[model samples]
Target: MFGRFAQFETREEYLEFLNAGVEFVGARDGEPIGRYNVAPGTRVLLLNQRDDKLHLDPVHWGYQPAWAKESGRPPLINARVETAATGRMFKPLWNTGRALVMADGWYEWKKSPDDAKIKQPYFIYHESKEPIFFAAISRFHPDALDAQEDDGFVIVTAASDKGLVDIHDRRPLVMTREASLEWLSPETTPERAEELAHDCAIPADEFAFHPIGKAVGNIHNNGESIIKRIYNPLV
Candidate 1:
């Protein structure tokens, strides 16, 4: 499951590809700056469809369904694509609440083959170093007695492809601009939505990854330095 990612693009940079007006609503502490290490519940930019048009919006990263809150269950940060459409927690948004979680890259920890307890961190990003979009789903939460709170979204994941299986068992469901638009369109049928979801898994070869320092393990360590590559002889 994906639990950390990086989004270094400025608001203007995201607007270049989004090509839509943005409404900043859920950014933490009202800070709209780019983040180098994003975890669950972190505020991130999301592209959502509304009234036949796409809009850039800020939303919480973790999906906290009302039932989970009532049951005291943990929020979900990643939902498997294979079960997202049928899973009880995710099915509601399968066809109508699709979204795009924008990020430049993501982080995954690889266990050392030689030692079960040893793990190394790697930063994965597009070969071209451009921003990548992860397929996502969003749901609204209630603030009071039937009053609505802001929407929260969860990134979708798929079985790891050839190049990534060695690093982890799952990878984020990535999409191209065309696939993103198709997935986010409310006009898309359930069958077509499933097809689009399967088609958007980014090829592992399209990503470049390298070992990074363990500083990233701490959520408090946030900055460009957190993603800098570091030599790992074991890797």
Candidate 2:
């Protein structure tokens, strides 16, 4: 359910991960932390494929269709994998568009019945410490945007795997670094893209999750503590 995530602060840090080929998006300097509000308009880096080159773009955090007068939608942060192929909002882009939303880790909330205000935060990431590549589909709104504006993108998601099911029912579709390059390859055909999206999954054995402090709820709070393990992981 990638509701909130940590992101790189500078273009240098962002490109370093790119040069190293880390492909997930929405990374932060901190971990195991909480943010109160991480609404749209937040500036985040996006790695998009264009003319065979990986273009690093910083776009607003939410997906906004210029035509829509009101953005009543919940954060346009994730596109359900099951419906991405045929849904009007995601189909056109997935048919010919794709990208790698890079991230070191992501956050999800655990529902609590006793206290509605008490939501637990967990940081999910690879056991090996590699950046996660969130399989994404993006289309340029060349005709949809006003003049002088550039392109934007959205991330694709699916039901959570075994490792994350306990924390949330859904998770961002993730790809390994090797698969990320292929997904971002301009030469990849539409058929190839569909196969990649359909077949891709990060095994439960490869990832680790841990509960963290509730400080992460504040979008303004950014630091290394967010990723710190609040309780020793059972794994």
Candidate 3:
């Protein structure tokens, strides 16, 4: 499962990745951001497409449709790729509501071998130090904010394998710029989106994870130091 992550890059730096092709909402210096510890149920940047133009919108980060609320289901922060395209909870978004969740990295907890009850935290980030674009699906509508409690989204997740399996059995489906652009493009078909989720996920070797202090377990604690390596990863 994926919950906590970081995105401390400047708006212009990130906008450089998407380039001049996209429009920015609240483009006035892009205030109120630079979050190093992003948790669920908070506002975050989402890159989505509408009206043949790309948009970078700050949106709520959880999804709970009216029917879900009436049914007493909690808001969803992550949606599984195994069933997202066909699942009832996400079918509405899989084809038309695809989006990109920008981040520097994410955190995961591993069970301590010495104690099953204890878990150690690790931060996973791209080896290149570039921004990560997590594939996502959303219920966001620029003109329909009232359609749900608030316009929110869910990151698409896939089963983890290779080295990352030791840290967590699942992870967010982080994608490359090319793959991310395709996912957000209106020209992509539902089948292609699903295929992209399965075929374009970044390899575990492309990411580097290292142990970090448990202070990150608390959402209230945040900063660049929060992601500092507790011990040298290479050692």
Candidate 4:
């Protein structure tokens, strides 16, 4: 359900937030800021097992198994939870490639009869002011694509929780510090995966949502105001 996100403005800002030590319940590696608009080709942070360590790397947002590129299907943005375990697009990784995607907040649109031509943007995140670590799942790139050009990733989405249901039909599988650590472990088993998926919802009282200006629709619009709370009746 997330289309737009807020990325850290500076590397230092990112380091500070990450160093706050709230997200390590899963993996320990840190990541840089990300693109405002996360699309298929966008590079995103991924946590994977490597030599007994959880390594975080930037990966392409689109997913294409090494042997399935010619399947004639466009890349998918979100992987459905109901079928991720058995779907042709997500099963391979479902067995053992879960990951974490770091984000400050995500954008959602609201449609109204009064403004058919525009959709209001809402920024959603933790009410605690902590950065959000969206739960993710990844697979090894079958091809040896350039590190900067060909890494791949996909976010897992679940049925909306009570507070978020009105905003979107599906919401990302947001990880808790504990669940992230469990999902990132190379030793994580299928049974463990099911447990993690079942517990991904954040309580309604733990989150905050606010309408922001239309400038956020433009990928070029990057500022704290994008997530600043605004009350506009038109929204």
Which prediction has the highest TM-score against the true structure? 3
Off by over 4 Å in 1: 18-32, 141-150
Candidate 4 positional error at 86, Å: 1.8
How high is the lDDT of residue 111 in model 3? 87
Local distance difference test values of all predictions, in order: 0.79, 0.65, 0.84, 0.66
TM-score of each: 0.86, 0.77, 0.91, 0.80
lDDT of 2 by residue, 1-235 (tens): 4667654344445355546443434343433323323434564456776664556555555564555426454436678877877876777777776777667778888777677666788888779766667776665543334522324567787777676788888887776556667778878776777677777677766878888887787777777876677864222
True-vs-predicted CA distance for residue 161, candidate 4, Å: 2.6
lDDT value, residue 141 of candidate 4:
55
Instruction: Predict model 3's lDDT versus the native.
Output: 0.84
Q: What is the lDDT of residue 160 in candidate 2?
A: 73
Better of 1 and 4 by TM-score: 1
Ranking by TM-score: 3, 1, 4, 2
Which window of 10 residues has the lowest lDDT sum in candidate 2?
28-37
What is the RMSD, in Å, between candidate 3 and the native fold over all Cα?
2.6
* Candidate with the greatest lDDT versus the true structure: 3
**Model 4 agreement with the true structure over 35-135: per-residue lDDT tens digits:** 55554566766656543654557777777664565766666667877778787778877886777777777778877657666677777778876777666
| Candidate 2 ranges with C-alpha deviation above 4 Å | 8-40, 66-75, 113-117, 140-151, 232-235
Q: Residues 1-235, candidate 3, lDDT per residue (tens digit)?
A: 7999998887667767756365655463554357888999888888788857767777888998888989999999999999999988899889789998878999998987777778888999988888888898987768764534647899999999888898999999987677788888888999998888999888988888889988888989888898898863321
Q: Candidate 4 has what TM-score? A: 0.80
